[model samples]
Target: MIPSFLVPLMGGSDVSPSLLTFKSLCYFKCSMFFSPLGMVPVSALVGFGLFDRGFPVVGHCVEIEIPMLILFIVLSQYLKNFKTRQLPILERFALLISATVIWAYAHLLTASGAYKHRPELTQHSCRADKANLISSAPWIKIRYPLEWGAPTFDAGHAFGMMAVVLVSLIESTGAYKAAPRLASATPPPAHVLSRGVGWQGIGILLSGLFGTLTGSTVSVENVGLLGSTRVGSRRVIQISAGFMIFFSMLGKFGALFASIPFPIFAAAYCVLFGLVASQGLSFLQFTNMNSSRNFFVIGIALVLS
Candidate 1:
């Protein structure tokens, strides 16, 4: 129920597991969507379970899903303490609903008849062997509210995609900034986190153009690392990033990275993201949202659902 709103969106169908996975990729954009990474693994498991019960779309999603999920969990947690000024409840709700509606709209408009189709959105392109991507269409495709949209790689769309990249890179920047400090250094510089986020932006924009979302960084696991170590130094995280760069250079890393269990990461991430959000709420000056006036504002958000 944690993903209470998402269950019905994918629309269950009775079919073979492979077909289900195909359907999922086509419609859900699963990995490509770059959702929280936590919820995704869970949704895949559910889809797989459905496939086992004779549903469809349960192929190899779990194989490639786990490590990316772990990375996502760790990065999300690491950023738990970084607070942007809180938006009014009405604003938050508006943003959430608007995103959902846009996703919904995109899903329907691009379908081929009743079956969603996007052969270009496959996972075949994201493996580490590739050198790079120079276009932006791939990144836009990842926002797969529904996979049926006609995701293209034409250079004509680059202008609009550049704008999208600017925002996605901004988000990537935020995630990178929230990681652990490395080494014996007590804390790292604000610039280091800034640079980290910038890296995240560049990574995703390029990868996204290839119809992938693999380049984004930061993990939620570092939250548990944070809660245990009580350290938020940027130096330590930079060290960790260096290590990742090293491991990534190894050919086998991609295979090994893909084998971790999906459900494990998703379940842990669900808890981690909620905690991160709560920690953000802890930043409020008054910490007094229970008042009648506050309730009215919060209620408006819930009503949109």
Candidate 2:
């Protein structure tokens, strides 16, 4: 489960999956809070069964998502001639088209049976040796201590973990703020923000319980996807979360996603990260950038970051 979260985080650290993943978390959170009953429908829609099998396509990472982007650009340009009322839907339609094209290419490659001859074509091809879903019970080797005992506490390790958690909180705060904006929604209320932070703490607790060395943090790439796709509905995000949990429980299902081609993900990142940058720039409007203090703060932060 930890690896599952970390895998996307690792991929996103270099690109923009962090935003995409964060957007998905917002969707999940919103759905759970406002539409708890929507879980069943969402689960059925985005279940692990969706990506059971697929062949890999061989190409430069950038090529995978470029055609989709081109399609979006062309569609956006064409839609400019339409009335304002129709423009929003048309823009969303263009995004949908882009997604369809990318999926079609992936499906085409898979259906072509290319992997039979070129196993390396798939991302994490080495995983073929592992079970699609881990069948062993997670607690098979677990045991409880026979007597009450005090364990030595290492202040250095405690402080290190605290530092990491603090950094994670800062990043998560930005993600929470950005997620709503990207979804075309208002910023979360104070209570909701507190809840989100509390959830992070809970996640860390669960990670420790599971013996994981590190804790989880929200992804920023998913948030970027919200801006690109303009799908801010919490119901959709809840469904995504459901899929993640469901897949983690089913080893084979999780493997299916792992098998996705790198180029396809990279292509999506190309579009998403652009939106993230644009969204970040939009924040400048609220600031008094003309002031020397503000200017230096922003400039130094940008350069250092």
Candidate 3:
């Protein structure tokens, strides 16, 4: 999964159309998809993660989340009457504009002299969640011993800790909803059903067994995007995938993306993530907010978010 802030940027790369297909399928595509203010929470958390965890950790975006997610979204289509929306023109327009800008920026960033450093992200071993798995709280001790070693499960080094698999699963689930929402539609693939989710569990175990598993197939924001957009065509998403594979081998391409100034990336992400947050809030509008429980829920959401 990409960091909440970085998603807007990293997502912009490759065949833009295909990228949308994949993101729309992500459990949550945009942090702001639910609340126009959601970016506040999304950005804050990611910013907090960056400071608390570090950049590589914050910038990390795993390709692994796609296959596993597509498998699930394909089956979600089976649930009937799950759709809602008047297809707000503004939301649709906003979603396209926001995603395009970020995608374009990603292409530009990689096009220039920036993407020259194509160090394989897979080669380096990182701490659990890259740094997010740890915190500053002195009393907060890590109970999982699996996190203590390097990721060389097959090479004598231990495979990644079990926690990575656990956390990644949760996040990817979230991503499935986020991506489509940003586009102002419900994801498609009518065969989608609860039974399909079983594939994800299988993936989780295999990742552990192989020690190469990383990234969440579902994330809150990634899925949120899909809930908003309703576009879930895997074939369309292949375009972006083609570019991504090429970029992986071409250091210059990836570096170009890494070139944009932090300020620019921040501003761009702020818009996208903020939109994502609003979508979340809009979804909440369906609930009875007058109740204290709901009131408290909204209140806490505002305070923390």
Pick the lDDT winner. 2
Give lDDT tens digits, candidate 3, residues 162-280: 33433443333333334555555564232341222334544443343333335224433333334434555666457756876566555544554444333332333333344444554
Q: Pick the candidate with the highest TM-score.
A: 2
Better of 1 and 2 by TM-score: 2
Output the better candidate (1/3) by lDDT: 3
Off by over 4 Å in 1: 1-200, 204-225, 284-291, 301-305
Clashes of each: 27, 20, 108
User: lDDT, candidate 2, residue 4?
Assistant: 42
Q: Which residue runs of candidate 3 sit more than 4 Å off their true CA positions?
A: 1-151, 154-161, 187-233, 300-305
lDDT against the true structure, per candidate, is 0.35, 0.51, 0.37
| lDDT for residue 201 in candidate 3, whole number 0-100 | 44
Model 1: per-residue Cα lDDT over 1-305, one tens digit each: 31232222222111111122222222222223332223222322222222221111123333233333343444344433444475233222322233233334323433322223424332332122122222211222223323443233333344444445444433333233223221123333444544544454445443443344333444544543443345566697789779775665554554444433233234344443443333323323333545775556444532441
> What are the C-alpha RMSDs, in order, of all predicted structures?
20.5, 12.9, 17.4
